[model samples]
Target chain A: MQKNTFKRKTLPSLAMAGPVSLWMILFVTLPMLYIIYISFMSRGVFGDVVYKFSLESYETLLDSTYFKVILKSIKAAFVTTVLCILIGYPFAYYIAKKPKEVASKLIMLIMIPFWTNSLMRLNSWLLLFQTSGPVNNFLLSTGFIDTPMSFVYTDGLVMVGMITNMLPFAVLPMYSSIEKLSRSLLEASADLGASGRTTFFNITLPLTFPGIFSSIILVFIPSLGIYTVTDMLGGGKVLYIGNIIKNQFGSIRNWPLGAALSVLLIVITGLLIYIYTRFAKIEDMEVL
Target chain B: MSISRKQKGKRRQELLGTIYSVAIYTILYIPVFVMMMFSFNNQRYNYYWNGFTTQWYAKLFNNSAVIGSLWYSVVIAVLATVISVTIGTIGALGLKKYEFRGKKFINNMLYIPIIVPEIVMAVALLIIFIKIGLSLGMGTILIGHCTFCIPYAVVTIKGRISGDGYSLEEASMDLGANRIKTFLNVTLPSIMPGVMSAAFLSFTLSIDDVVMSNMLAGAKNSTLPVLILSMNKTGVTPDVNALTTIMILFIVIAMILNNFIRNALKKRAKMEENI
Candidate 1:
């Protein structure tokens, strides 16, 4: 009777998990395998995949132009990461310090804009900063400049877009970690002879290191591979690593080269994530 | 209790903290402020304040393409949400209750989709759909969405099930209820918050997707984000601003309705508790 009951319970559990498991293996694992496989193949006369194995695609990736693209992408992503950290850390800190009810509401405010498509947000930025846009017109009216500033499609504007897109990803994780900090530690630091400055650098900063590390990883990796923001805001004038990958598939029609670039992206992301895991447990990664 | 020189230094540090806080909030809000202000602008160029007009909003609603694509987006989002939540709830419960092999692998699989670049996932799925000869349309979009959507739903519901209580379900079963009866009477109510939240989240995410929809869309199956993106590529238009205003209006209306219904239910629940 007990064995029958055990079987009954177990059967349902297995049944429940079965379909989702199969879905994952097929859609996720299989595609990942295909990416690796495509990375090894040669490009055909047309855009078709030629089955003959060759390292030509990987070799193409090693070309100096590719290196410059990778370096530029990294530089942009890095600058964006730093700005996000500077902007996000204290915003998170302020929110975390609020009462629970208020904190959630504040978090909602931060996230509400996010609910709108990111592309919409980028378009709005363009509308706001374009030559005839309000900022330029206002500046012109105020006698700040005789000519309208060419803000859109510039490096500065691209950085602005990148930072705006990534700010939320930086804040949410840091907020979770900072919120979990023990009140007594702050109290104890006060109770002792330590000043607020010493306590923060010595205690609070150290405690929040895990969160800071995650903020870096989350912002850096996505900023590296995100071509849409750069493509739209950069006016297709400047290319990030992401734009290059998109070019291969869309305009360049080099699937093997694209696959190789994607493989490189995957490696970079994996290595960073692995490093982040060393600093902060993956299980503790707060989903915003 | 000690206010020594060291404590003075700490107070100074806190002052620095205050400075840091102000600077950060300014950076975060300035762009948002610009966007919010322009939404109310009368002129087509957000750079100039011609005069305040709601004409953009009026024009937005008149756009047949935006309206049609929005309808399609809503249907696909709803379908994807329903499918993902059902599968996710069952999967979360299964993962929570059972000691199964490959649990680790399954857990990692879910995380991979969340962290991997959306463009990469979009391309990979597109290639696979072509390789397998799956017809690209609303169906492909729905399926592609669910592959990532179910993972998020699963992870969320798993956290919810693990927290709080499951004792009610155990007791209900002990009192001679069948498994289905126990679930209907106990498990469903317990996880309803999770279910609602997960559904809300999935709907929001589905509506926001551009890359995946663009990759998998049939010639006829354009979503609002895709339409907006194409229009953007052409150049700025007052129509987009108007369309955006209309979309924002829809979202605000939805939020207000949700709040009203939730408050009514909460009031009823409180009355019952008092009784």
Candidate 2:
């Protein structure tokens, strides 16, 4: 009986857990390890790893060009994060304040665009804001502007794209948190004679602080790393750290430098995630 | 009079809130709506609003490159979904059922795939693939995708598996149904929605992905988004718009179908409980 019991326990663990753990160890963990390993290796003359120990890649990170790229990427991501919160908080508030059915429907509306490929949305933005696009035509016809505005291929438009892409991430967590807020708490605040604004500040904001922080981390980290928006919307004239890293691997053919840049990104993401866990439950980190 | 004034104030606040909601949704969807509308434009360049035509849709349908990449994307998505979901379901069950060393650590590790930026994972996979001399192609792209896709599957399936209060497997074992039979008959049906949802989630994410796929894709095996991306280097056309609309429509249909199945399953469960 003891032997049978032992077989039962071991069988499930081996049969069920073994394949996935092995897959992750092979594909995910090992690949991440390889990235770190290569980050310390020297860049080969022919664009391959040279297998010699060197901090040249990390030194390259301190180069003025890379430093500027990293700084610019952080600024853009910070701007995007702030804008997402500014736009999404009120939107999430509106959703959470609605009846449950209406709220779910509104949430679904937010998600529909989210699930669609972001490249498509960015394409549409390009099309809409292209030279002589509808907005320019309307402004010209309405006498608002004398000529077509240079709306496409601008830093401003890239920021706009980032805001749209990251808005849902900000909204989902805040909305979920706000929905979990007890009506009695608000009612009690009112009963205690707090003004509407006072109640909102005291009761609503503090309660949803975790959601707000989660939104910040979620939006900020991806915005830092996602190059697609800048690549398409900025017309490749601009470069974030993502584009720089991508160029390193693609055109520059510097794998070690690319790996080093990736490690920096990983560090930034890890720090933000560590902060996020401190503020909120890990399970509450909902993007959908 | 004060109560009436308070009620009026609340009513006005609600109205304002509704308007804000509408405005937010409008900003969120205007680009997508514009694209969908422009997809039917008779003109290739979107400078002017030409009369409606299904020409772009027709052209897209006949476009060999678009069709080929789409087929490749679907094949990759389906395979990734099947593999990831099977692994995820099994892993979720294991994590829930078995007490083992590093269980807490494994649960925490689930978030790494999600928390790490896609580019980092993309570069990591690229570096590793090159180190191992695996040629960049669909195979490389598939491995890159599964790296993140497995974690997504685990999150979804594990949530469902753990949320249940009772263990049908334990009950079945008590009744002399063997381990395999209990899992097949009891546990499988119970978590079918989670499995299906995880499958859909992985499939959608895989199909819609661009960065990892682009980084890992070979010259001859461009996915549809990658194809569209290449086209964007020149300029996007209404045909591309039409293609996107189709993809969006396809996903919406898939989601609705999945939701329908979930609802039906819930209703059947309700009936079973009543009986």
Candidate 3:
């Protein structure tokens, strides 16, 4: 009877969980281990991985060209993240303060852009800011500049694309966390004669730290890996880490070097995640 | 009283906040608004308005490449969604119910695809596909999408199931219901919304995916986003804009339907409560 109970219980659980476990192990975990393995292998001349092992890919990373590219990628991602925080915080704060129905509707409005293809959106940015595009045309007609300034194919344009791509990510998490803040806390601060600015800094900002952290993680990692923005907006002049990794695989045809770059990207992601774990529960990582 | 002055100051703050929010929202929608307007533009590859025509939309429909890519993307997304939701929902149930040794470790591992960069996954999968002598195609892309999407399904389903699920399941089992019967009658109905949303979310992620498709897609099978990405290199055409506008319309209709269904459910539940 004990064995029967055990059989009934464990069987269903195994039948349920077993397939996914096997799936993850076979597809996800094993592939990642293979990447690490390939990262150590040498690249053949024909754009294939040779079985012989070496650290040439890692060594190549220390070279000045690769170092500069990595730094620039970090800088771009960092700037985009900071700008997202600055832009998104106030927007999220305002949305959270609205009535529930209105807030959900406003959030829906924010999501409209995401429902469309990103390429479409990025292309629109190019068209909007192109030399003879509307923004430039309007500015020139209004005599803001004697000539239509070069707007498209600029680093500034790439930055705009990055911030735009990531702003919704920053906003949603922060908004959810901000909405959860009880009104009584703010009312208590007000009744105590605390200035509004003082209450905001002391009470509100710190309360939403988890959301901010999540936003930072979400925005920073993707921005670091973003290649399309640079490809279209920057006209492929600037090679961020993502573009570099893509090129190594695409045009350069060096599998090991690309794998090494992938390994580095993973390390950077892992480090940030480790730091994140120190601050918040892993479950607190917001999907939206 | 000082109350009037405080209220006046508060009003000013609110006004400023309102203005700031409007400006942000405008910037966010500016691109889409431009695309919508441009899709009607008579000029080819022209951002400036020469005249309004739906030529781009007409051309977009006639483009076999766009249509084929769209069909491929939808089919792949559906397959990926079905596999991920089934596997993920089951995984969520198992993890939530059992006290396994590696439970904590597995939960942490679930965040990997969420946390690890997509490019890394793409490269890793590309290598694996090649090493295993599997030619990259729709199948490879499907597997690639499934890898990341499963985590999302797991997260979404787990959240739904973890809420009062243990109590509900135990209560059902306490009755004469067998395990399968309990799941079918009690748990499935309750979690149906979560599962549906999970399906939708996975579909969106898979359909919108560019990186994995770019890597895993073969010479013959290019998804819409992958096609669009390549087109962007040569500068995107207005037909692409038209295609995007149609996609946006579909999304809007879906969201509206979802909202109506949810409201109806809420109303029915409220009526039941009153009864």
Candidate 4:
């Protein structure tokens, strides 16, 4: 009787979840499978999928140009990640130590900028830094330069845009983790005669490693795949792996190549995520 | 009760804290301030502020293409939000309240759409859709959006679902309410906050999305972001700045309003406690 009653009660909930599960399997899992499959398929001259199995795309990935692009992507992502961490860590520590009400307000400030469209934000950066813009005007007026310095369409500008875009993602997780840290530990460490610097390095840093890991993943992965900021700020001359993949599908009409590139991107991202979760508990990485 | 060198150390730390805090806030605000100031610049070029003017804003309103794309974006955002919330609420409840085989696997699968690049998802769907003879249009864009939207909704709703007090549902069921009736009367109200936030998030995400929407939108149905992107490619224009400024203003106002309402409620609760 108990078994029957339990089945009756639970059946509807199971049914409720079933459709969503199927949808996830079909749309999310199946497409990922398809991407992997196409990565192995031969590319035809007409840019259509040729059904014959081959490893040509993976082989092409070994070419120097592709290697350079991948290296460049990694370097760019690394720089962006470093900048975000340096800026975000102190900001997060400050907010975390504030009273609860004040900390919440500061957190809201970080989030409010994020709520604005990322593309729009990128565009605004373009406007503010355009060669003839106020920045150049100010510099020229100060006699810092006789001519307006070329600002947009440069790698440095792209990095600045990327760092701005990703700063919040690094801050929020670290703030939460730092906030959760026990104050008594600091008090305990001071009592033991350790210098403040030593206490911070030994105690606070170790406890906050999970947040740092989250900041890296959250910043690095998106910075790797996002073409919008780079494309806008870098003036389409510079092509990250993301812009290359986008071009293949959009302008180049090379679906198979795009699919192959995507498969590679996914594989790299998945490996990183797997490594990250191993190093830091997945539950500890939740940002929100 | 103690006066020592430790107090001196704390004072130095506070002084250092003030300097760092001031520098960080300046870094955060400067770029945004530059953007906001240029919005009202009378000069056609952002390089010079000729004077204050609203001409660009006027031009933004008069442009038919911009208006059309904005309307379509709004419509798609609303539809996507509605569909995602319905599916996500059901999915969250199921995950929270029940146990089933392969549940862990299923839960992980939901995250795949979110973590994978949108270009990958768009291209994969494009290949499949073309193979099956599905034409690109509003329907395709909506589906593409929902694929990403569902995961976000599930995550938000799942958080709230786990925190809910379920005794009301148990009581309603014990009083001979059917499962569906009990869910409506007891469970639904408790989960409404999750649903609302999920819907809000989905709407914002859909409206801001350019990658998938750009891919899925056919010749007939270009989105606002796409239009702006092409305009940007054409070169600098004051009209684009005006449009972006309006979008920024709308988002900031919405956020401030949300915070204001939340603070007001908190103040009321404090007063009630005192009384």
User: Evaluated with DockQ, which candidate comes out highest?
Assistant: 3
Structural similarity to truth (TM-score) of each candidate: 0.91, 0.96, 0.96, 0.93
Task: Provide per-model DockQ scores.
Answer: 0.51, 0.67, 0.69, 0.54
Give lDDT tens digits, candidate 3, residues A1-288: 988967977777788878777777777788888989988999887887788989989998889999899989999999999999999999999999999999999998998888788877888898889877898889999999998889887789999889988999999999999999999999999899998899999999999999999999999999988887887688878679889888887878888888898888889988988898898987887864
Pairs clashing within candidate 4: A132-B47
- lDDT, candidate 2, residue B194? 85
Model 3 Cα shift for residue B275 (angstroms): 3.0
Using lDDT as the measure, the top candidate is 3
Chain B TM-score of all predictions, in order? 0.82, 0.91, 0.94, 0.86
lDDT of each: 0.81, 0.86, 0.87, 0.81
Error of 2 at A263 (Å): 0.8
Question: How does model 3 score on DockQ?
Answer: 0.69
Residue A33's lDDT within candidate 3 is 89
Clashing pairs in 2: none
| Residue B261 CA displacement from its true place in model 1, Å | 5.1
In the range B83-139, model 3's lDDT, one tens digit per residue, is 999999889888888766667766766787887878888888888888789988999
Q: After superposition, how far is residue B190 of candidate 1 from its true place, in Å?
A: 0.9
Q: Which scores better on lDDT, 3 or 4? A: 3
- lDDT, residue A188, model 1: 96
lDDT per residue, candidate 1, A1-288, as tens digits?
988976786688678888788889988889888988888998888888998899999998779999889898889999999989988887888789878998887787776667556776787678778888877889999998999989989889888889988998999989988999999999999789786689989998999989988888889888988877876788888798777877777767888888888888888878988887776677677654
lDDT of 3 at A61: 88
